[model samples]
Target: MAIVTMIRRDVLTLPAAELGPDNPLPPLRPLDEMHRIEDRDKEDLPGDMARQIGYAPLHSLLPVRVRDGYGRTRAPRDIDTLVIENDRLRATVLPGLGGRIASLYHKPTGRELLYRNPVFQPACFALNGAWYSGGIEWNIGATGHTTLSCSPLHAARVTAPDGGEMLRLWEWERLRDLPFQVDLWLPEGSDFLYVGVRVRNPHERPAPVYWWSNIAVPEECRVLAPAEEAYHFGYERRLRRVPVPSYDAVDRTYPLNSVHPADYFYEVPDGRRRWIAALDENGHGLVQTSTDVLRGRKLFVWGTGTGGRRWQEWLTEPGTGGYCEIQAGLARTQLEHVRLDAESEVSWLEAYGPLSARREGEWAAVVRGAEAGLDAVLPRAEVEAAYAAWRPCADTEPGETLAVGSGWGALEVLRTGDKLPGTPFEESTLGDAQTPWLQLLRSGSFPEPRRVTPSGETLVAPHWRDMLESAPAQPLTEYHLGVAQWHAGDRAQAVRSWERALQLSTSSWRLLRCLAVADREADHHERAADRYAEAFDDLCQERRDDGESWTAATAALGHEAIEALVATGRITDARAVWHRLHPATRRRGRFRLIEARLLLAEGKREAARAVFDAGFEVADLREGAESIGELWARITDEPLPAHYDFRMRPGHDDRPA
Candidate 1:
């Protein structure tokens, strides 16, 4: 019953590219067919996805196919429903219109929780459970459907966001190295056992519906989305799965059975895609989901506690207990994608089993062409090697929205959603509560974890801080409060909170980036540069199957900053700061235009020109860069242009400049 909203920070509509044309580039190798499909433009325009476009599930143009030169198609299996039964529980997977698990009926207690893993953070379900209670995990919203599973094949339920019939089953099929073919494993005990629904577009114009699988799960879970690194809420983790953080009763208390402090918010490189697999404590399989398929995917690991860990707690509702869900993807899509076109069909796959589902000792899922088999085992080395070729975008790109200098300086804006370029908080604010406490925290105070006395009174302010200091400050709470403070306008306070947070938590690249940004904002350029550099080092250390692009991007940003200082004729300052920065932070987009300016300053006019010529005009100068309107005076050498209009930035409108 949650409202999910997708801000198309990176949403892009790619025009369909003609396929099957003879010999454009060297003919794609017959063995590398998957690569060809990826290169091909999507049939459905990859437009900016936002709130659910329509109630119906999203579909594709035609049945995706996977063709191996050897006459093999790595397609996923079709199933009516994948039932996972064991001593403790029973659940089923039904594929439907959207590639998701239709229903999750916890038979042990007759309590059914329907959700998806839009972004794969644990503590998904039982938000109102009787265990840990806090709004930490409530950062995301529920969309049309949520998929569930411990393997490549997912189980999901397609629900009516507007309170109508809410149930459907689905799974995704993929040929080894090809796009996925979603297979609807029709629901059981219902009329949709084998029949797939072809949803029609109800509105005349395209509608944008926010949809994502709200995967509900316990607090003691972790993810493996291979990216530069994974962040919870905004905190990062070191390991994919770690022990749950202990609940510090002295900090601010939330609802029991809730994921507080740390909420998994996986940061994937733009245009990169891949699947994330989740495992339990015993290293046994638990759940896995994927990001977009075109770019090589990466894993985002998130949890609570020191390092990357989760806070162990039980999920008990009015009657049920110990349940959770994971969410994945942005919440919205254009109505066109949701309303099934007459000839369009959407497909995916879902498979599940107890901890002992697969006994062959193979511990991974393969994503390829349409053909996907649960029991299929290809060379693990080959999978990693093939995927490793692709790199991810840097996580430090300008916020989602970007407005480069138009060809004519026409003030052109390419907007997907309301987020500013290079901003990450836009997505993190999704489902977070606008509570006064949260509001105050967002403003400046980094609230420590809640503390409850023996009599059970929630602590706040001085008392909360006292409790946090008395015991170990919960990393998640500290980070959440720090972010809250940052949003609330106390940049200095937020920086302090994050510094304290870093002491207890380790292994989050995003946090490292945040620390860098926070220090920069405070004009502590040396510290910020150092932090960014450290993030790059950590990124290199945690290099997984995917995510080099983002790492590169981070480095790019740092370098950009240095380049900017140098361009503005501050070489000595730039060099001093650059030296202080870690090698990783010095590599990529850290200072995009700033670098160009620096090159210009150093009299490397051609190099500077190259930097500018390489789509530098298109560079997102909005992040710390002065806005066009702000720069008008400088550029015009006169009063503001008469035709120019100005307004404050979205979230900063009311704040002082």
Candidate 2:
């Protein structure tokens, strides 16, 4: 019998703002209006005619006129929500909000595993500049919350092969022109929620993408993962190793009441198996596990501070209390980008459910219990007896012993099989089936071109070319082929291969950026400038039309366009482009330095000084402060004072210390 139900209800939500040509905000210039430069030559105009026509700013302070609201108000709207329940677990999903897992409840304990927001409140957090805290958010594409999180998704209720009910939610990511779908299944009497995610690139080109599952929990909850060390980004954005749970004079194993926020990406010690958990003070919480595909586990702490609290409240409903995220990624880390080839799809299964342990050692006992409990559900005697009674067949494997032990692990093992050489299964096959290619891609150890010596002559391996020819439509194949060609000293052929790949699909901003670099190297100044401009425009347009806020790609393309314009001696055009960039991108010290350079070129000495001062203030917040300072000295031919402190300043006395 089906254990899940789908229904529509008029849930209370904060209304989205309606801003466009029909309804616009009053015209009011920003404080820095004098610094803004108009696109006199129409060089900054969007290449797409549809976007250029009837486009005007509704608010001077905002770059995109059509933006969602950032306010708390009571409004009732119909939303499709899916309810899945077993004897011990009850969960809810909101299809309208990117099919978010709105609530997860443990019926026996009468506790909510996920922090449920009382009302919908969007804040300037996600990559789309609007994110709501709580539940589990499926983020795909580039880093940060995906563009689809706030948008409506297509959902359907289907029957699993085992006759269980499943809710499948899917959407086409317009920004990258990729399609992603998540299938949520709850067996008739299982305690866990089985999540199967698949992301596909239908075009005949490779795309660099990222995927993360952000699971939210209360601030008091502590995260546990099978990792000896965690990576912390230094001031220069370079990752450095720190002890797991406790490092840098801070205890990360157990949640602390510190005012300083922290974000860490933990490397799973055993790359073969990956799992993460969050336990509350009572040692009751949820554990998520995946055998393959999802490898990276991350912990994000907001800390107890007035600013962080305010931001947390803004993201959710006020008085909901603060929460943190336990994130899992398909790549090694969120900072790492993976390539998905044309007509290729990566799929994986993740299971999350309630877990409990005695409160005696707090986190120590909780971790031990979770580790011991992962592959066991019934008593050990019962599991052993069941295993003995089971018949062995050609497909029988040692890992199949998990079937009689833990329900969750059994499903995963049966679906994927034991890790060994020359398994009957082929890796190239796609869909819900488990494949070795998915495992390789998830491990972030996909094969690369190797140098080989044949007939006393060093040559690039033919394996890369063979793969490309076999999957000519695959984007990664073309990209790798180009890399091989470049390494073989065939620069022109490499550029042609990349250009052809771009023609197949223009979704990869990285590929576009690389092509532009090749153009610059070839002394094609005009072509390089044009390519940079197109890349920048595409990134900005995605933010404007698809609600995909600024990302690393956006920052890189913005800088590339600025530098290309400066190289072409189009100073005014560069200034205009800089001003039109997303506000978040403009806040970066690197972009601020670019702005300062433009001001200096225009002989605005005082304005340039003011820009440099502003950049210095925020430099400590990001890495590359020392580099920025060095660049400043070189630009103005003046050394910085020795006494200047580049570290982050303390918060106000009124805030948490």
Candidate 3:
């Protein structure tokens, strides 16, 4: 056998609900608003590194749509998958779901190298929202998981460096407005899977770039990286440098030894190879190595604490085993974004496979053995040579189309008239989502929908905003123009635009919600609450079961309205709005929390406590959020339960109520 290399289409029967309609609200908050990690505890950092942490910050997620529409409800559904395989290894990639490598199997040992998530549970983990845990995830565009974590990406067949058929995944990262591609191939009879990744800047100005290859490995493995010191970022929102492997007298190399979820960013030296590994006691497990352009290496461990275990259960089925993430990135840490100059592209090749290290004296001894093992089998120079061979192939046109991504890429291409080599965002791929913007690009005016159903995607790019400004001053145009103005940091202009839209009969609930956010940001809480209440009412009245998309918008708006009302001491009105919510929406875990908040606001402490006793899970709880824990503390003085104890650090009392 000449080492079989082929790609095939397959189906996976999973209990996953479709990520329903994306939230219609333009993401008003900055991407890092909740993160608040800049210059955090910088006393322990090098001066240069501290400066990079705050550089090139993204103000908001304007052009990208939020994907909070998915719910906990799931049924047996067929999910499409593509398998790229050679004789020694087989990799399953979900092209429709962010081109996620769902599983990688080593054929000879009958072992799974990556954490193969047993269930498809959509949680609020990705940057835009919906995210599932498992396998090798290609994270590009910005920090956290890419907005494309649960979205589709274009996939096609291309010639590999070894003359084998490779699976290529490409997408337009809307937040950064960059085109990127990931090529997956297993060379003839090779144990390691090769990945070629490229991110290109087609614009005239410089742009910040962030890329991380997040690989999920089983917790049974010990994480190893080439560094003596590591920068630790805990959920407490603190960053400090600490010794590797033996931090706080607990060998941090073992994922389970710690008691909280945290990230250990290894400071790979200027001349060292970029690599990280998770290996078992027998020293046989997955190792990831990359070329120089990808500089960062990290180990994200959800440790042995109850909260970590609970998060593990929350991300998948309750009984599934826990896992850790070994990631490689372009900066020293995920919190930092490197600047990519105009018309420049960054490219690198990464290889992942099983390695055997036959030594076990200490952490250093184990890491040295692992490095020796890697060099003996697949040397660092070989990886560099492979990257050199793949450089020219990166520009080769895609051969056969396997899947299609969002039409936003094609719309961008239409507006900019830039041909992204290799990753073609063809005109034929345009769809309903791109209709209004496409019309604006061609006719020089945005077409207004007949019904004020709060439908259609919003575009906030400068080019689109300029076109909207030039278009007729219709309510729709003004509404979108306000969003663009807000994104451009012009709050006064944004307010004027929304007010102008409201002057017309075609004004909508979506416009009202945007104005409410502006008011809230401006510290006009009472006025903001009124706008939120009105927006929710209008949204509910107009939602004629219009579709799942409308329902998601309704739920989002209602949630915001209730929070505002409760915060402003409008308990009676909040209750009224809560009752007006659809029964199904009221049954959601997040809604249950809202109901508890309402109970507490109404002076029913015992009832609010009973809500926790009833045992509900907020499936979409954020990583660093203290909302649930804080609410529990407010309701009672008792110790938090194992299921609810997700605190990653101390000083809970210091947090504001």
In order, the Cα lDDT scores of the candidates are 0.30, 0.55, 0.85
- How do the residues 1-657 of candidate 1 rate in per-residue lDDT, one tens digit apiece? 222311111121211111111110111112110001111222332333221222333221111111101101112333343442333333343321122343444433453333222221112122110111211111111121121111122222222222122222212111110112122222222111121221112222443222233344433333334343332221211112121221222111111323222333344456443343333444333333332331222222222221122122211122222333444443221121233233232222222221212212211231121013212422223233322321111112332121111010010011112221111222222222223233233343433334310011112223234333344355655654455455435667766767776788654554566677666655667666666556655644554432333433334434534633543455756655555444533332324344555554566667755553353221112111234344333323454332222221222122211
> lDDT tens digits, residues 602-632, model 3?
8999999999999877767776666888999
Find the 10 residues in a row with the least total lDDT in model 2.
Answer: 398-407
lDDT of 2 by residue, 11-47 (tens): 4343332211110211111211111123442343323
Candidates sorted on TM-score, descending: 3, 2, 1
Q: lDDT for model 2, on a 0 to 1 scale?
A: 0.55
A best-first ranking of the candidates according to their lDDT comes to 3, 2, 1
TM-score result, candidate 3: 0.96
Native-referenced Cα lDDT, model 1:
0.30
Clashes of 3: 0
Model 2 Cα displacement at 645 (Å)? Answer: 20
Root-mean-square deviation of every model: 26.6, 16.4, 2.4
Q: Taking the candidates one at a time, how many backbone clashes does each contain?
A: 161, 4, 0
RMSD of 2: 16.4
Error of 2 at 161 (Å): 3.1
